[model samples]
Structures are given as structure tokens and as C-alpha cells.
Target: MTDLHRRNPYRLPVLLLIALSTVVGLSILWEFRLEAWVMHWLALPYDADFEDAERWRFVLTATGFSLISMLIPTIMLRRLIANTRSSYRRLKQAQAKTETLATYDSLSGLINRRIFMEMVRNQLGLKRPAAVMLIDLDHFKAVNDQHGHAAGDIVLVEIARRLEAIADDNGGVAVRLGGDEFCLLFLKFKHQTELGQIAEAAVFQLSAPLSSAVEPSALGATIGISRSWTDAQDASALLHCADTAMYRGKKDGRSTYNFYDSEYEKQRRAQADLELALRRAVEADEIVPFFQPIVALPSQEVVGFEVLARWPKPDGSTAAPADFIPVLERLGLIPAMTRSLIKQACRAANRWDDHLRLSMNVSAGMVTDALFPDQLLEQLRQEHFAFHRFEVEITEEALVGNLEVARQNLSKLHEHGITVALDDFGIGYSSLYHLTRLSIDKIKIDRSFFEPGQTDHLPMVEAILGMARSLKMQVTAEGVEEFHLPHLPSWLANSGCNYAQGYLYGRPKPASSLFCYTHSSFAQQAG
Candidate 1:
């Protein structure tokens, strides 16, 4: 207790105690003095009584003062003890609040990832089926890009609200697993199919656009499901399965759900092997370049080649882009593969006649990276290749996110003499809108238009071709396998498309085979 506190109004009790004790002691002393006087009077003559009374009064005053002094200290000590107790309670409450904030997510007020997963472990002893669903936002990056981070924050807040609504009253808990990922645990469910439905309902609630502080926002989710009783004999195994299911959801396209399966595990192992081999193939310099001839219409002479990426394993096998690209992208190893492919293709383009051009593929992630264009230019210069001799191909889906960054970066590349072509033009969101913003040189028509309905679909194809022509962009047709050359050439020419590349011309092949075969045929024609 400090001096200031000792003097606080709380000390009034001590002061009163001291005052009361003093009065009581004085009364007692007075009574005792009277008794002494009485005793003296009874024993002796009356004349000496007055003298004795004065002496007794002095003794009474001394005794009263001593009694008060003893009581004062005891009262003060009791007050000090109470203050210590009150302060201790307040300290404990503060500590408890601090711990709660540290372990729980502030936005949702749900248990944090650290504690939630621990709960999963503790559920194992109950032996009842419990499901863990990892819910991830489908287009969260798009939301972040379109609106600012503040707007994105609102979307997350709205998501938390929706989660609260969907929480089952019977059994289960919802937790925010940090940033756009949430976890739901269902204690009584043994089957994944049942769990998946519950997860989907929870995620689907966010499909309706959410209002944000900055702007109206929308996001979707993919759920990865794991069940304790169905998936594993133990907690760790169940969690691993759930984690695997989450990634599977990410792959099958977002805004969807998937359950982990033993079959998927086998395929996952195979996919892993292929990815490793692909990386090794990249390192061993086993990846080779192939080109599809892009001929100028009317002239019918090959003016350029789109540099095709090919990965041929040592076991006399080949992997298609579909088989290996998803893995590469997931691993963030596409950039390295892309770098290697670009240099090899650029070198080949340089070796060819100056007129022959090469178009390299660019992923969306690569295009927006500030360092990407510079590094590419550096590689081209290092390889002694001219930028004008190259065109870069990007799929519409690849350019889906981060439009502004992509537009600016791509514009820079275009200014530096690299032509841009949007590949698989019709397969992704709003190709025409993309074309309006992006400075593109060409559009490759999706091959689906070519199969089985060419006559019926002629008008749609004509419209697509016309759209490209209005933008002053060249059009290339893919999947021309076994088509009549005379018919395709005439029809495409009539529709304003000038380029065609598919198996009809040649499958992807080594440069040596290309040089030996296509060049020889051209020479024969010249002769």
C-alpha cells in the first residue's frame, strides 16, 4: 500500500475503528477508577478519598490511551489485506482475457487453427465419426484484385456471418482457419457423402453477393472433406485425408466439393512420380521443343511457328500439357519450365531464317510478375535472339485474375516488340471483354467448333472470325486433324482466318524432324 492509498477514503473505516476503540477504553477506565475510589473509601476514612480519586483519574487516562493504540493497528492491518485480495481478482481476469484473444480468431470469435486441430485429435477417443471440412474461397484473389483489401475484408466478414447461419444446431462447430479458409467439425457423421452435403450447404450460402464497406462483393468456396470413422483408424490419418480432399477440390475447379478417396490416393502417387520425372527431365535437358507451322494464307508459305512445349521421358513415353501442367502450376515450378522452354525455342527461331517467328506460352502468374518481362528480355538477349521474332501465347483462363497488372505488363511486352496471342479464346470468361482491354495480335479458335458440326456451326465460326478481323487480329484454327486441306483452306480464307495448325499439318515433333520433313517439302514445291 502506497502512502496516497493509505490516505484514501477507504481508510475511513480504520479511522472510525480507532475513534470507537478510544471511547470504549475511556469508559472502561472511568468505571475502573470509580471502583478503585469505592474500594479506598470502604477501607479508609473519607478525608483521604479526594486525593486518591485524582491519582486514579491519571491511571485511567494512561490505560485508555494504551488500549486505543492496540486496536488501531489491528484495524489498519485488516483493511490492507482486503485491498490485496481485490487487486488479485482483477489481475486474474485480465490474464484470462489476454489468453482468449491470443488463441481465438478476432473476426469470427471462433477458435483458431491451433486449437481446432487439437480438438480433432481429442475426438478420436470417442470413436464416433467426426468430419473436418476445409472451406476455401474460390475467387478470393479476384475479389481482392477487383476491389481493394478493405473490400476483401468485408467479404470475409460476410462469410463469417453466413457460417454462423449454416452452423447446425444438432452437432458441429465452425472455425475460421485464417484467411478465407474455414473448418467445420461434425461429431456424429460417419459418411463423407453426408458430410459433403453439409459442407456444400454452408459454402453455398456465400454465393449470393455480399455487401462490403467499399463495394458489393461476391466469393465462392470449395470444400475438402475428411471423416474420422470412415477415413482412418486414427486421428492423423483422418486429417491427412481431409487435407488431401481440400486440394482435390481446388483442382476440380473451385465452387465445388470433393471427398478424398483411396483411388485418388493412387493417382496422387502417380501424379507425384510424373512431376518428379518432369522436373528431372527439365534438369537433364531432356525437354525438347516442337513447332506447329503457322502459314500465311493465300501465300500458303510458313511464316511462323508457335513454339510448343514437349516433355518426353526416358522410357519412350511422352506427357501432355494436361497431364503435367496442373502439377507444375501447383508446385510453382511452371516458371522454371517456361524459362527453359523459352530459351530453347528462341534459339531455334534464331537458327531458322530471319522471317520465321516463334510464339512462347505465358501463364497468368508469370505475366503479372514485375520481374518476369525483364528476366525474359534478359534471356532473349543472352541467347542472341531478337524480341521481334517472338510472340507470346496466353490462355484466357490464364489471364483471368489480376487484369490490370496483366494489361500493363503485357502492354509493356507488346511495346518491346513481343506480339501477344490469346490461346483457347472461347473457352474462358468473356473473351471479347479480354480482347477489348488487352493489346493482342491473334486469337486461336477453340477446336470444338471444328468437330461434327462445321456446317451447322459455320455462322458462329464466321462471327468469331469476323470479331477477330474487326480488331485487326489474325485467327488460328486448332484441331484440324484429318480435315480436307482444300476445303479448310478455302473456307478459312473466306472467313478472314489466315492461320491453321493441327495434326492435319503435323503433330508436335522434334525440330530435326520438322526441318527434315517440312523444309524438304517446301524445297520440292520450289523445285
Candidate 2:
């Protein structure tokens, strides 16, 4: 212990008591002793009988001294009391302010997640009917991106005000559960329809334009509601159910609301399972690249292979790319998975004829990464693979929100002789616009146009081929799977298309299969 603390643990209280006693003693002595001293100085006994004039003088002098002594101490004591009360009030105010900071959101002036959870527990303890509405703001990031974070904060504050007003009308409480997410707890409600109406009103209120100063496009909310009896009785479970429903609403289309449904929960669990399996698959290297040949139409020469992801099961079956690719993209696992696949494919392709190129597809999320091009180049360097022997295939969706970043990254790759192909072309609304902006070396017409029963596919194909020719970009007709028909290959070759890829050429096969094909006479012919 420090010497100061060691001297006296209650040192402050002890000194305070001594000071109070000294003040009291001094006041008592001044009121009594000082007047007696005056009497002694005048050589008069304080209680002695005297003539009328002398008695008046003594009485007035004694009363004046007593009044003066009492007044001084009384004023000091009153001042001290007032200061103590004032200090106490100020301390209380500080404590209340601290509590407010702890329990409420400073930006929105609503209860924070901590307080919301506590309130949920309290309501659950009461065993009363209540519901939790989870609200997620749609396109909130776009506002932050386009206008700046200060504008986003203003939007959140205004949203909180509207939510608070609605919660008050419904006898509920509103909470800001961190960025762009909020919750409402309804303690009084009759039926599900009432909650639905309240949710609709909330959506409408939140979607209205804020002011003339800030013009953001379609800032809205998606609300998911869960009840005490039907969905969940506990706080965490209730929130989970509401979150599941909210996500479903978001996936279906934003700016709407959904009530808790068992199907959403099931899907949530299934997705969770798939995500776990995919993570394991990525870690265990079970997800590998299977190459499908892209052939020069009419010549039937294998120019390159489009690398596809295959997750092999123990039963010799494989999971479809459609089933797990979206999960990988959503979990931000695409870059890691893609990197692994690139390493494996590059090592395999490095042993193949140098004339053959490997085209690998990248996810939309991967294109947004500023360092992705450098990372891929570095991986190729580590594998001793030439940049010109590799190609990147990205769907039109990859160019949506990250056009500039994608352009920058793709340009870097193109500079290093890595070709960039706009995959799934003619499908997105802005494919033509993307072709003009991005560093696109080729365009792959979407396979959907060539599906069976697409009778008018010829016109669309002709238009795309004409555009590609005008731009001096190579065209690849995808899903030309009917090679048995002699006219299909001739039509594609005569239409000024450079390549075609689908089941008609060959299904995606393993690396070991390529070792034999590379040695065959057909491989020499394609070469």
C-alpha cells in the first residue's frame, strides 16, 4: 500500500470530523466568551443591578455581540449546506448521463442492443404475449457509398425517429441494433394482422423522402416479425426467427415484410449445413478444378479449357456448382477457394502443351477486391505459369456495383497478357454497356439463349455476333450441345464466332484424363 493510504484508510472522514468540531467550538466561544470579556474590560459585572441608562447600554451591547456572532456562523453553515446539496445534484446528473450513454444509442437516442436484450429477457420473464420485429435497411450501403457516412448517419437518425413514433403508437419499444439494423418489441397486440399493418406503416414511413437537401434512391426497410407463442418464447430464439424471416424477405425482394415461417427456418438450417460442408471442402481440398474443353468451331480444335469447380463426395458423386457456389460467394470464401483451384489448375496446366490456355471463372465478390489481380499473378509466378496461358472469366453480374474496381483489376491482368472474358453475356441488362467500359477480350453468349424451345435465339445470336465483330472482340457460343446436328457447327462457324463450349465438345474431366489426351493424335490435331 502507498504511504498515504497506509496512514489512515478513513483519513478523509477523520479530518472532516475534526474540522467540524473545531468550527463548532470556535462559534460557541465567540458567542459567550467575547461578550464576557467586553464586560470585564468595562469593569462591570454582567448581572449586577445598575441605573436605567447603564442597564440599557449593557443590554444593547450584549445583544448586539450575540446577534453578530450567531449571524456569521449561520451564514457560513447555510453556504456549506447549499454547496453540499448542489454537488450532490451534479453528481447525480453525471451518473444519469453515464447510464444513458451505456444503455442508449447516441446517434439514434433509442435503446441499444444491450438494453434491448435486457428488455427482452424482462418481457420473457413476465410470460406475456409479445413479438420481435427485426428490421434491416435496404440499400443503406449505397447511401453511404454515394453520399458519405454523415449522410448515412442522418438517414439512420431519421429512421429511428419514425420507428420510435410507431413503437409508441403500438405500445412497444424500438431499438437500434447496430448499423442499418433495428428491432421493435411489441407488448400489446391483438393478432398477427395488427402487427402486419404496423410493419406496413413502418415500411411506408421509412421509405418517404427525408428532405430536399439529401436525395438518396429508395432507402427502405425489410421487416421480419416473430411472435411469442408461434415462433419462439425466448429472446435469442425469437430474434433468430425474426432474422431468418427478414433475410427471406430480402432475398425475395427488399422493401417488404415477412412473418415467421417454419420453411425459412428449415432453409436457414440447410444453408448453415451447406456452409459448414463447403468450408470443410475448401479446407480439405475436396473442391478441385475440372476442365471442359472450349473448341474452335468447324475446325473442332481444342484451344482452351474452361476450369470448373467440382466437389467430390465419398460415394463418387459430386455436388453441383449451382448448389454451393452461391454459398461460397456469400460466405466470402470465394477468394480462398479460387486461389486453391488456381494453384491446382496451374500446376496441372503447366505440364500440358504450352499452347493450351486455362480459363477460370471468378465470382462477383472477387472482382471487387483491389488486390485480387496481383494475388492471382503472384500465385501464377509461384507456379511458374505464364500469364498469357491463363484467362479470367467473369459474369456480367460481377460488373454491377464495382465497375471501377473491376475495370482497374481487369486492366492490370490484361496488361500482363491475361485475357478477360465477359461470361454469361446477353443475359444482364447492361451487357453492352459493360463491354464498352471493361477490359473485355471476349464475350461468351449465355447458354440460356441456346436452350431447347428458344426458337427466336437466332436473331439474338446474330445481334451479339455483329456487336462482337464491330468491337473486334472474339465470340464464344456457349451450350452448343447438339453436335450430332451438322448445321449447328457450320452455322456457328459461318456466323463469325471464334469458339464454342458445352457438352457437345466434352464434359469436364479430371487432370489424369488430360495426360492421355495430350499424348493422343487428336491432341496434335487440335494443336
Highest TM-score scorer: 2
Clashing pairs in 1: none
Winning model by lDDT: 2
TM-scores, one per candidate: 0.54, 0.63
Error of 1 at 207 (Å): 6.4
lDDT of 2 by residue, 1-527 (tens): 22443466576446555655565556555444665677889998785343557645555565556656665775676577667768988999999999998999999999999888888878888987779999999999999899899988988988899999999998899999999999998876459889899999998988898863666988899999999878888988889999999999999989999999998689788988889989999988889999998887667778788999998887899887887888887888888899989999988988888888899989888887898899989999999999998999999778887899999999999999999999889878998888889899999998888877675888889889998999999998888785435667688899899998888777898887775244233336435
Query: What does the lDDT read for residue 328 in candidate 2?
Result: 88
Q: Assess each prediction's global lDDT (C-alpha) against the native.
A: 0.75, 0.84
lDDT tens readout by residue for model 1, 1-527:
55544469567567666766776666665555555587676896444345646656766676667656766775677677677767987999989988897778877777778778677777777665678777888778887788878777777777877776666542777788898888777767646556656776866776766665544444678887877656775666776787788788878777777787878978888888977887786776567677877766645566677777777866787767777778778888888888888877776666677777887778889987878878888898999888888888988765677788788888888899988888887777689898999889888888877785466766878998988878898888877665556687668877788887766666676677656224333324335
Clashes of each: 0, 0
Ten-residue segment with the worst summed lDDT in candidate 2? 516-525
> Which stretches of model 2 miss by more than 4 angstroms?
1-83, 95-119, 136-168, 173-183, 208-219, 272-285, 293-304, 313-316, 327-336, 351-357, 361-378, 386-505, 517-519, 523-527
Query: Compared to the true structure, candidate 2 yields what TM-score?
Result: 0.63
